[model samples]
Target: MRTALTIAGSDSGGGAGIQADLKSFASVGVHGTSAITCVTAQNTRSVDSIFPIPVAEIRKQLRAVLGDFDVRAAKTGMLFSAEIVRTVAKELRGTSFPLVVDPVMVATVGARLEQDDFADALGDHLLGLAALATPNRFEAERLSGIRIDDVESMEAAARAILRLGPKAVLVKGGHTKGVLVDVLYDGRRMRRLRGRRYPKTLHGAGCTLAASTAAYLALGRPLLAAVESARRKVAAGFRQSYRAGHGVEIIDSHAVPD
Candidate 1:
């Protein structure tokens, strides 16, 4: 089986972050490995607390997996600080495989994942290193300084983010109403990925999307094809979502192909 690694935080709630990344990798038929950077005391309702493991331990976890496994691809979730980001970026630089970085700034509940100051470094240092950077409307607005209210605005956001130097940028449109349209911009082209919007959110949709993209890239899909494949898979995951908690349904096993 192919191996993929998820370097992310663990959510006891099992909805988003590392839990979601593992489920996504498994659902996609890739053997999943993980490196936990932080642990959160979260339930379906909300995040109550978080414990950050030492950066040394985080590096150890990363070293253990990347050292042994022929890791095909990797995805990163919440690093939560500039030092941790720098550590992860430094370690990943030597790998031949593709890396997908999800700039997880805020949680679903509006909690800040990183301090305000680290936001700039995250964009400057980490994003430019990624094969792909997945950002939501808010994150795009923050990273790209572009507010997206329409398709044109979304394209502008994608372009601005691309300038930060990721090979590509996928701007998720969950923050937009009417339809769940995502805008992906590579230096060569601009494409809008559209899915019929799901009114209720299934937990970990973005994480699932990003993880699936990494898995697909590992399987040799092109960047656009990777995003397209993952986007479709994530859409079905949302459609098949089930109650993992009282608050929201999770993408769960739906990351698997039909």
Candidate 2:
């Protein structure tokens, strides 16, 4: 069986991070492995606290998995510090496997996930190494220094991020007022993935999408196809979403495929 890896934080709530990534990978029929970078005391309402795992330990986990498993593709989320980001990038430097980098800067409950120096570290080391970089509206804005109020700005932000050296960038527009449109720009062309706006607020949608993309890539799908499949999976996940806590609903990573 094909395998994919998620190098991310562990969400104690099981709504996002490594937990969500593994579930999403399973939903798409890929065996999932993980290298956790941090652990969080969190739930649907808020992130209570976070403890970043040591960089050396994180590298050890990566080495263990890469040495033993035929991991075809990998995605990263919530590398809480500059050191962690640099370490992950260094580990993945020469691997030919597809890498999806989810620049997870903030949580759904508005908690900051990365340190002040994280942006520089990620740009200098990680983004260029990624096959694809998935960042939400706020994250895109933070990375590109462009306000994304509409599709035009989204495009601008995507182009700006593309300049940072990723082969492609997906700027998620779920936070927009009306329809949801995610912009995908590979160095040459751009595609807009349009989806309906669901009434419920859901957590883990980003992690699910990125993880599913990695799963598809592991399955040997091309870059664009992997992204499209992942988008559909996330939409299905949203339709199957359920309230896991009083604060907000969580997307069902195991949503039946359509």
Candidate 3:
């Protein structure tokens, strides 16, 4: 079996972040490994406190995993500050690997998780280096500077983000109303992936999508194939979403496909 790595923060809530990523990877038949960037004292309701790991430790965990594991692909989520983003970019240099940058910024509990400059750094230094970028509506708006209010707006946002250099951009419309219609753009063409609107906003949906894409990439799918498979997996996860926390239904990573 192929192996994948998730470089992200840890959610003590077990609803998102590294926990969700690893579960999704396993569901897709990939061995999952992780290097945590932040640890939050959180539960189903809200985050109590956040403790960020040192940059040196984060780098060490990444290198140690890379040295020992033949990671077929890697996904990054929730690198919460400018320094960590720069550090992660520096560490990924010269590695011919498929990278998925989730560009996580906001928490479900209304706390901001990324620095104000992270989107700029991501566009300038990190995105071009990624095989793909998976940003939902709010994150897409932050990344592309194009506010997405509808399906047509999602297409425009994906195109704008593609200009930042990821070979493919999957702009998730999971945040929109009427339907969950995700848009994919590659500068030359566009594809719309639509699904029924699940009634709830599950925690960690973004992390699950990004990590599932990594799993598909690790399994040797091409970029578009990876995006497609990730979308299907997330949709099924939504259908199987459960009430784990207080506010929204949390995605059952057990919804992971085999």
Candidate 4:
């Protein structure tokens, strides 16, 4: 079986982070491997606490996974600190496989997930090596210094982020009003993808999309096709979403294609 790796934190809630990534990978029929960068005590309602794994231990996990698995593609979710981001960037620097960087800044429950310097570290060391970087409206604003009020500014944000060195940038429109529009831009052209407007935001939806994209990439799909496929998978998951707690609903990672 083809294999993919998720370099992210472990969520005890099983709704996001490494748990969600692994589930998304398996849902798409890829063998999912992971290197946990931190552990969070979180649930549907909130993230109560987080414990960062030592950089040395995180490095060991990455080495162990890369040494054993013919990891076809990889995606990073939550590197909670600048140090962790730098370490992860360094570890994947020269790998041949495609990498997806999910610039996770805050949790679904409004908890801050990154250190103050985390964004700088990611922009400097990691994004340049990414096949694609998936950032939501808020994340795009933070990364590009452009407020995305509409599709035009959204494209501008994608362009600004593309300049950060990723092969491509996907600026998600989930946080915007009306129909969901995600813009994908490489240096050449821009492709705007429109999706259904779900009533509420699902937890881990971003992680699932990024992970599914990596799964498709691992399965040898090209960039745009992989992203489109991943978005479809996420929408399907959302249609079948359910609440595990009283807080927010999570995507049905279990309700996946065989």
Model 1 worst lDDT run, 10 consecutive residues: 248-257
TM-score of each model, paired residue for residue? 0.96, 0.98, 0.95, 0.98
Better of 1 and 2 by TM-score: 2
lDDT of 3 at 9: 92
Tens digit of lDDT per residue, candidate 4, span 130-237? 999999999999999998899999999999999999999999998899778999999899989998989987888999999999999999999999999998888888
Q: Flag regions of model 2 displaced more than 4 Å.
A: none
How accurate locally is residue 247 in candidate 4, as Cα lDDT from 0 to 100? Answer: 88
The stretch of ten residues in a row with the least summed lDDT in candidate 4 is: 249-258
Number of colliding residue pairs in each model: 0, 0, 0, 0
Clashes in model 2: which pairs?
Answer: none
Supply candidate 4's per-residue lDDT for 22. Answer: 92
* Model 3 regions lying over 4 Å from their true place: none
Give each prediction's root-mean-square deviation over alpha carbons: 1.3, 0.8, 1.4, 1.0
Model 2 clash tally, residue pairs: 0
- Candidate 3 minimal-lDDT segment of 10 residues: 249-258
